[model samples]
Target: MLNIEKTFDQITAMGPVHLKIFTYIMQMLRDKYDVSMIDFDIEKSIFFYGIDSLKIIEIHSALEARLNCKIPTEAFFQANTFKGMIDDIVKSISNDGNLGIETSHYSLETEIQEALDYLLRDRPQRDEGYQTELTHTTLLTGASGFVGTFFLKELLENTDLKIFCLVRAADEAAGLERIRKTERKYNAHLPQGWEDRVQIVIGDMSKKRLGLTDEVYQEYAKTIDSVYHVAAVDNFYLPYNIIKKTNVVGTVEVADFALEGKIKPFYHVSSCAVSLLEQCSDPPTIIGLVNGYAQTKYVTEQIILRIAEKGLPWSSFRLGYLYTLGISDVDLDPNVSFKKLLQLVAKAYDKVEDDFFIEADAFENFLMAIPEIGCVPDLDANFDLMPVEYGAKAIIKTSLLPMSELKSCYTFYNPCPLDWSDIVNYFKQSNKRIEKVPLNTFVDKYAEYVRHTDDNSIKLLKSVVSSQLDQQLNTMFRQIDTDMVKEDIHWCPPCEKQFTHAYVDFVLND
Candidate 1:
């Protein structure tokens, strides 16, 4: 093969010019990653299995800088292999120092179409053994996650079924301990004698078949009467490939696993971001989504719809930011939830606007976490909060319904979204220190502030909020009817002003 695994020096056969270009490319890759550890096969694409546009851009810039020459943007995408890149570089310099591709040919739409191709490739077939049955033993992924732990407690307390929790751990014992710790975090103690009924399947969703052996995978698949595929790589800013592996590929593997043996209800815990694709769609296409997390959800949901057409029963719960554990010793370690984020901000604040209800330190943290939310000058946004404790119950109840009764999309958003006006007033009423900070103004200004801010907390908060909340606020949306959600939107309380201060105090004390 022209492209083989070798160090930069091993390519002595190449002309001195080709050798220089190859060395710079390899060096640029090593700058950020341990190239020795990277399974680099020149025969393979610079992007296949690893690498992305960002790294490609980095390499392109480095090559240009080293060669003191310009490279067309399309060359990066076109030169998919090591040899191709070398050939392109040679051709560009030889052919009147110009390449023949335009930047307009490659766009976000093109990239998304490529991703969709990867997501839907090699569709798994329904095994002959596939047979639908009532719930007896359930296979659940993400059992150690924030909402997953609450879900574990719910299943343990409510059902006689044996629960197989697919957790990523070194061993079964380690996985059990992790589950125990998660349960304790939420104060949801494991039930006595529950050890016999709960089996921990140590595995990674980022791997094929949940990183289990075929025998083990198929064995569990045969016994599973229901599958709660809650596991996901939830980072809003993760590179598209990294998140896609878990959220999209892992989902397909789990769904295929469901189709492999004893069939049952497939309940996927997705995010409300899937709707964002449509919200921002100029012509209403899934490609409208920009972030990796939301794009994965949209792709996975589309896959599920296709799977459902084949009579594989499934239901998806498009959840919003969930707040579980109420106010008692409120859980915040996950820090992924919006409520937990507010809790972090609460610590940075000192006092309430009323000048009595909240401490200054608490108020300070709140402002820091949401520096702008603490002093929102405008009131034109909506905050959706679904308490996890109740939300998990709703999932269990809804998933248990007959497949014939389920809808394709079951969004669990607050029926009455808390108005940004009421939210600002709530914080204002709590602390006079808080000022009116317009969300639009705050977002525009803070976008720059976040760039220069050295605080990791602020940076992380910015990354999460910018991708999810910023787009959400800009998009025109209404509280969608939850008639098909199987649970009343009214069943879940909104993020109200009445409990605003109390919530902060509870989070602070915890």
Candidate 2:
């Protein structure tokens, strides 16, 4: 039904083992649930399709019987997508009886050390007299990526500098085509005759000389004014080596590039999710970061700090999660952009405008149910959501300002985070059929439904649970010191109701 393993020699990104299991599971889904394999999204909940509770129960039993192993019901609830289910299966089998995350075999500390060595070794004599002056040219990595494309557009609109894009392509023509596709795909409105001012360098971050010949690379070094490092592997589940090679080693390479010739100010887009000290004035560390992506980001920051110690002035933006609503359809490309990464969590929006909207499993239904069962007192935790467009503009504008002015306040997140309980009454007032059950009752229902759930029965339960925990624990909640950064262009926060409506509209229409 869904065996791509035999035909997957052509698909190198997915290894044979994964390909085999995935093909098997997808085939089972098709055969047992009447699911179509065409254009199947691995990140979407099966409930988003026509699959209901009865089919899910049948599928779960069928899979267990066929595989001759215990497949946890929680996995179906937690790993909502088919791809995630495959990963869950792999992890479960690999762990045997153990129930913890898979750890990387390689030394992550070694990966961090290599970045420091690259920046410090065979060091180019510093351009000690280099002054931060008006920009004439700028080098940017990840121009074809989601945030990169937006940042690229920002640079074009705001500055007079000629932009040099470091793109991974076979040749200049290919690079241009890639750029064209990325811009159109993201609806990046490039100004007319924008091509003249932009130059494309065909290169790979993981390779030597940025995958450029020594001669061409040197020519590039001589022409650049600044560096914007935004490209990265954002997958949380990817292996440590893949993350380290790009986020750590590739960072070292970029830092090296910035130092040679006219030493330029390096703009590194880091993440706020990096473990912060319990207090505001505490040192930044990577202790609490759970995934490889966050860990690598932490190491990359450490590398940048080391390079700065070597006399290169740099600016690091501690970016927050981008908003995942009301964007053009082109934003949801298969690549791990903000939109795609947030897909599973956004399933509530996906069902809001459906014909069965009242019958769907929804986020608010769970929240509304929380108080009745007293699982936890009404949670007032802040859950701010910043629109990507506003955040991108703020980031680009802030990056261009003098570091001293904005360095301390380089954070970009919801100026106002949402509180779950605060919004519940509003939903109730609307007289919608968002049922409220006791928390324990809801849990029992969830247990029953994962076996055979349909009718919008909390498809994003895992995400909802995580969010609830985050709120209850105030785990990562920290005040946004927006005053530390200059706001050249003010951001008007969307009203939560209006904001949600727009997102719901996009999901239904799409």
Candidate 3:
């Protein structure tokens, strides 16, 4: 068990700045999370375990306000320990005296550089005679996820190649059950006799060799004809270090495995968020990204680019927001972004007090608070609502392109995007009217609403609103460039109103 008093006493010899940083973070943790460390490592991050990413943002804001200094968001995300984070915060605020130990000195750029070096340290030389066509088998990761579920359905229905799904599970049966669960969630079905075509390989991307034994790893490396990597931590608010093991390092593991035997064509499923920094110079800097998910994807794409430069046949499919899998009906994940937004509206209109809310600083209070306050911010943003089926089909179509003709990257964003005003209008048609107000007015209204509320959900909501007003600004997504996908794949999103209407109707009723 970790002793809080003893740890503070040890740090007391350090300067006041160190003490202030430590005290602020500890107080914020206790107040927001109601956490008192019982058996945690003092040498580990204050965000060790059970601490949500939103809590990190809260601590970040409180430390900034207390110290009256701007600490880099990277400092919090990159630090390995609570002590090191305090040390960095102290250095940021003060220059006099021995300002504790300066740990995590590298920027996001340096971290990405070092990670790239390590992942590509002992790169294997590619073998000759790469198969341009589908062979006997393909290895797929994230087969149980939203887009991957449709990818699995596509392969099983269309191709003669056997699919080896690399799933993280206790065994083959559990892995199969997870796949079945995803299928049921999407109301998607596999072709008859699908068991004969799909094999489950119990493995984890976070581990070396995908958590496979040496013999099994080598066997798959030699036999698998292609690689389709779709797995990721997929959280926008999490720090880079928290998701690094799975998103970045796991990608490297997959890349290494692809290069081990007869070189396989790697089809990496990246996010359109990589477009956030697409305009950067040859090697994009990680500072331009808003969150860790984008940062990790940016780094992974850089790694894949380097590998592609090394003559590994690779194609990256940068996907937009997969709104739903079965577009015809109400087959959607409850946690999908647009659904959450609609849910907030429904909660607001009905005066429903739901205990469960997706806790993230990026989303925080605004979505739900909109209805409570009876006003919406002029968010001036649009969403690239790509159906999961379209994304899956696009990936498959491009992956099958002749090796010589395939572009290095194919970005899949919806040609017909949904604007914020369109969504507001949709709700109006459904008989829920919300006033569209300026950003400041919305903030003012939210503040007034917070003053009168003492509910648990409102407490969490106020933690963000009262701490930082700028967090209330909508997270604007820039238009993604999909020229490669447009020219090569010749695909467009199904613009039928049925898709949007079904999505809206489903959330409203739920």
Candidate 4:
């Protein structure tokens, strides 16, 4: 039989540094989640143990303090597996004689290109066995996410198909509970007897075959009629290598599943950020992008396009910022730059008397901060905000179109987007204390204001401030070309009409 203690003893024999790092990780797992090191799979994602982005941040901070050296946050994220993370920690420790930045020979662009080439090879052919329409069953990934909850709602309410929700959980009961939690959180209405129409398939997208067994995987591959892949790690700060396993590799796996069964129509939810990158670069270099989230999304879209070329009926919906329909605080992506900025602004304004920043309504903090600071950053960008409900419905309706009429790409963004000045104007009318200032001026003011408080929130505020100063981020929300999408899908509802105070109250009041 296998002995975990013996293996751990062997590890401890390597070196004191290795022993310390390994011990901390093992202890953290045990103390926090009641998980033992032996039960942890070295090859699986750290998220498998319920480590979220916030937890990763906390872990990195503690490791940095213990090791007495700087560790890149991206390094932790880039480590897709537990073993990869431990290895990276050791390498960081070993090279800390000078305590300088760690350099690597890895190239992100080359990695993207190679992964794409590998996926394109031996493309699946459409035989006579292919089904022409989505009739009976469909497979949906990211059914528990913000926009995904809406996707689940749309499919259940509008279609007669049974859905196989690919969720990461310990078992079927756990997966179903996860979906129920999402439905409650997002206020998604589930029809009576809805459980009969939905099946929870416990799986991880970051793994091969989506962490499914051979028999079960093959069964779903043969039975599922279509695919909706919306699940992704949306952290903006993590680098490409870290997010590649889920965003890029998971996409490839989903495509593989789609092609394996009777050829299915693959509806991919892409990002408008890709369009922003393309417009900014004469010829975009994947490595030159500002964040890993955009890089992985770019690569995933290319993969979908290649699959479309190989006879799979695929459609990509390039969505912008997906806002809440009513403001129950469920549609927002926590990692999105816009939400982070709002939170930081809120913290800066709500400098509490304690050692930590008190949590307050982010929208309220943002609105209040403008008047106190007397200036808003002249971002000079239009927000292509789309309501979650509309985006979800649009994806479903467009995907259900006749295969021959299906366009390879459809852009979903506000046809009439609101400029930064528009939002400021609403607040200015209520409180004349605010005015538009240059970006640099706003950053300096924000930083100086945040410097007054020596707390944990200060670090996050500084990071967000520094990110705002990045030149690329300023252009991240450029006008997305939606003429083709509008013309192709004539019956599709408009994404948004105009930026109004009523709309402001709808989002900020809660």
Candidate 5:
């Protein structure tokens, strides 16, 4: 016989206050959704049976209201089991206890705001009375990229800057429509009259001077304050000449344009790959790679630095592996390294070799043979793992820094210091039934599995699995350095228990 009281008692033993909050949530669900064990096993239905993701958001809001705690956004994925959810709620209580944030006295908004203030202690104070007039109308290349989209969101949230996006199409109306769609997709609730805050300019980075007409260039010069150059060809396997033309020469054009316009501060997005292959004498490695992508980025960085020296207040941001919700669509282009590896693995799997072990062996050899293999050093390398949102926040915050405070031509903001080992451990723990294998071994096995599975749908499944692994790995790595960013910015903490509970409930339902 199931002892409901005893189950509740076990939860209460973990923490009395958290138990109260859980009781409140359960009661609310029962009343609102008519959810009950008899009705459909509430836990199993919500967690394992695969409730809508939007419903999870609703639950998050409900729990916050009941507990008077600001559950971190990351907690949604972390607390995927029933017990795990309760444990997370208890942990929230513990953290709040230290802050003297009593649920009985303080409103949820007040508590959330206080937490935000503490997290963003190092951020520049907002000047409410300062004239909202943006002296510079900035154009963001790759305005559709993950970093670009988040950057736009961060700007909207934190600053009064006017943004213009460079679009590939020459037609102004078509570009504006595309920008609108992007805005609606990311954030539907645009500030009243937000369209007035943005403009879409037709330009192509591949062409000379961004292919802008003289009249358009003059108008840009007169109105734009600076340009955030984020567009680049990232195909690692592409010919050196092709990469050089787009990444290197294209950057030279952008720099020249910025210089010609006398834009006060030009921002360039470089990759951490630029800091590869070269052995550094210090405790941590800082030197970059010899590969085409890294080498081109290094050259671009030098060009931007030279531009800064020649009177333009230019800043180069060396970003690391970027992870976000829509990353599969934005970051993982078909030509990128990860996608290429997946394709290779998929093709190898299709051959139907005699033994899985043989297939795995071949895949392992292929991964190892890749050039410029460098491990992410110092589990806390700031740029090693960064969430798209946090990365955007860092970029916007740094951009807003006063000219006097901006000392370096190149500034490195490591978004998060998450450990890959933590991610590997997490996967191992999550799928305990699956035998733990070394990364190389796992990759081999995965490749072999893909090869042997005859179903056509397996290709999509493999892609999804790879993307999830990338996301989890990136999250773990960012967690290593999140303390600094958390201290300096408003980022939701990981709600490990809630996500775990959710996962458990989901599995049970399935």
Candidate 6:
């Protein structure tokens, strides 16, 4: 057996303030709970094994009460080891003696006065050195989507670049207003006077020449230095003809416009799914088995590659699923059969069909971890998942790349390596009764169940589940080869398990 005592002694000798705090914490637990180091499995306990739900709350409460530090729940997960946990707690306590809130409760008027004083003290000071260097006017397509929203906010926050957003309709003012609302909704900390820097240009991607009249096209062509093409038909169930019209042909139109105008660079948002669905003779890579969406993305990539060969200063970013702070409100796309299965399970449980049961929230959280959510043909597959904010930051960073780097048709960016297993474990932790069925067993049982049940929902659910299992298994065997550009991407800050519990409490009470 590994010498847990020796390892812990080494950690203690490190003399990091956090390690000292942890030592104190361990002593407290030993005294109060009679929790000996021997009773805890150093490797398997909360420290090394990852934070399960209950342990996260206990740690958070302990920190607040003992050290008077208000630590975020996400911190527990990020601090995967005991040493890391101690470091974070020590930093939090040292920075502010009070855990999270002020040390003492005060009158409402006094609190308001204190808040105003703090805000004023921290206000940004204008200096010539702080002035922005970005001078060129830029154009952004697909300014409505999640990535688009984050990109717009970042540009507004960091640079003085004048932005021209492409809208589908002639009501450019209304579109711009909507963009402002979205910015405020997501980035409440945005600097004042940010909206004044943006302008909107009405143009439809589907229209030939990007729906731009000759006069407007010529004017924008002369002025705009760069174009960020973030728009695409993200739905998988949509027909090839429709997808081709928007993703491929529309892209060509934008490229043509940029080429004619002599624009320095054009940034395109492409999905990692483009590498999917190739034959065994072709180079092996994990193809997301979602459906036509992946295939269409592949075709779209070919279009860009062809354009690149002809000498267009363009760069393509292949990204995985982009999630936002807001839970997806778009009902499960029709193509996600797993969603159908969930619906079926929900219905069957209403009739008390079996002793086994799974809650809707657990199923939804599980789906979020998987690649296929808003997209169709919900295949059980792993994907590089990144928060929308991180994805946008990467796109902006890539856009700033030199013309020489823009020569390639594709440049892969992998921002987050959120393992699907971690998500599965989270769901399992949330609900202990719903045992994890092996992917094969899940498919086999689902198929058998479908044959006996005439209900359309159940049939659809089984089909989706079986297909997803097959896809997931195939992905395990097949892997794609591409040069992935890794960057230090920010993830959603870890929150305490109490936060999730709080959400659950609110939902139950409501």
- RMSD (Å) per prediction: 9.3, 11.0, 7.3, 9.0, 25.9, 25.0
> What local lDDT does model 5 show for residue 277?
20
Q: What are the models' TM-scores?
A: 0.66, 0.64, 0.73, 0.69, 0.50, 0.53
Q: What is the lDDT of residue 365 in candidate 4?
A: 44
Q: Model 6: which ten-residue window has the lowest total lDDT?
A: 125-134
Candidate ranking under TM-score, highest first, comes to 3, 4, 1, 2, 6, 5
lDDT of 6 at 510: 23
Please provide, for model 4 over 364-426, each residue's C-alpha lDDT reduced to its tens digit, 9 standing for 90 to 100. 344445555678777655655556766776788788888999888888766666566667677
lDDT value, residue 312 of candidate 6: 56
Q: Please, what's the RMSD in Å of model 6?
A: 25.0
Off by over 4 Å in 5: 1-134, 157-159, 184-190, 234-239, 277-292, 325-383, 409-416, 439-488, 492-510
> What would the per-residue lDDT of candidate 6 be over residues 1-90, giving only the tens digit for each residue?
445576476566866665656666676456654566664543343544444344444445555545543443334433446655565555
After superposition, the stretches of candidate 4 with alpha carbons farther than 4 Å from their true spots are 1-52, 55-109, 121-129, 279-289, 327-374, 447-478, 483-500, 505-508
CA lDDT, candidate 6, residue 292: 36
State which candidate has the highest lDDT.
Answer: 4
- Output the better candidate (5/6) by lDDT: 6
| lDDT per residue (tens digit) for residues 63-139 in model 1 | 65567555544455556576676756765666554554321222334444554455435635444534354557898
Q: After superposition, how far is residue 108 of candidate 3 from its true place, in Å?
A: 6.7
lDDT of 3 by residue, 1-510 (tens): 257766777678776767767777777777778877554455877656566666665566566556655555556655677787777666655655243222222254565667667655654544556656787999999998766888888787668888999999899999998988777656555666777888999999888999999999988888889989988887654556678889988998888787776778899988766756454443333332344576678778877876677676887878766654343223334334554444543444343223322132223233545566776666565656665766877788778878888878777777666565655555556545678766567656665665455433443343233222322122323454553344322233333364466555544445
lDDT per residue for candidate 2 within 115-167, as digits (tens), equals 67666666454455453754799998988876787778778888998999998
Candidate 5 C-alpha lDDT tens digits along 228-289: 88878764332234366678667766765665534446778887655442232212221112
Compute the lDDT of residue 135 as modeled in candidate 2. Answer: 70
- Between prediction 2 and prediction 3, the one with superior lDDT is 3
